[model samples]
Target: MQETSVTKRFNELFDKLEHCDEDEQRQKIEEMNEMINEMDEEEFEYVFTTELFNKIHEMIEDKKISLENAILLLKYIGYYKVLKGIRINGFNESSLEEKFKEIIYDENEKKDEDKNEIIFVDICECYFMLNNQFSSDMYPICAPCLLNVASSKEKKEEAQKKVEVALLALSNSSTVNV
Candidate 1:
């Protein structure tokens, strides 16, 4: 998988760290090593992409990326694939089923806090849209979208920011909200 390249690159960086005694470099290497050791290729790719989406969303919110371009970026990343008519892979048919079940179970035992329904709705719509466009409808909106949507509204500066967050949330593979 492509993630192996990421791991290998990290290893090369770690080797180079030996030439320097900086605590920060060592700490970064240790963190990277730990992540590489703990996660498989699929998980690493999912997490990496999710983190990148969040960072990009942050840039958009900060006005580093224009709203029109942000929407364009969303299209480039496959958000509009549903409208284009793509099939989504079903969770039950994927290896992520067990992990999904575990996460749902944990969430079910937790208390619900008052949250913004609009953001949630937007996220759900975005998920469905993307699922129908890029993958298959069997794909459910995952946890990351739900969490990010709920949290992002707290700092929303414009309508476009909310939409961007919703798109970013849709891209994450963590949870699928029914």
Candidate 2:
């Protein structure tokens, strides 16, 4: 697909993200969010390219983006995915979930880990949105995260049904229980 103006602008933003400090990175990502927010349905095609996922993975690996900003970007990915009603068996672009799983599971292993309930919730929301329906190789990673948040007194309110379906899917899958 030809690169539209939006994609070109997003590319420029991604380049700037590399040289930016934490505060600057946040500002750039917020700008990105605004750009996406302004897009019409048809313009979404430009911003929703595979390159977006690729850049997100690169930025994450390079530590050029914080977890909060990473989550912000993923929200748009999931949002556009829903808008396009696109679902397929394999994403074939990036194993984005593995990176997040590492972050989350690492936190899970820490002593006195301040479980950022919003992180877990946002991740669960994105996981479901980015997957093929509720099924993906992400089940193992997302299942635990979702289950954990589902038990939270404050954070569980929105994810009740998601937690249930993840449980049902977990029982049916051969993925070893965590």
Candidate 1 lDDT over 1-178, as tens digits, reads 5446556665455444434444545465455545455545354444334334444455445655443333333333334233223333432233223332344344444555644344334434343333322233224434444554546545546855665645554555334434
Which pairs, if any, clash in model 2? none
Question: Candidate 2 — worst ten consecutive residues by lDDT sum?
Answer: 169-178
lDDT of 2 by residue, 79-155 (tens): 55555554433333456655555565665555555766667657665656554443344566666765665454544
- Could you tell me which 10 consecutive residues in candidate 1 have the lowest summed lDDT? 91-100
Candidate 2 at 13: error in angstroms? 0.9
User: Residue 151 of model 2: what lDDT?
Assistant: 59
- Alpha-carbon runs more than 4 Å astray in model 1: 1-7, 11-97, 113-166, 171-178
Off by over 4 Å in 2: 40-46, 49-51, 83-92, 103-114, 133-178
How many backbone clashes does every candidate have? 14, 0
Q: Report the Cα lDDT for residue 85, model 2.
A: 56
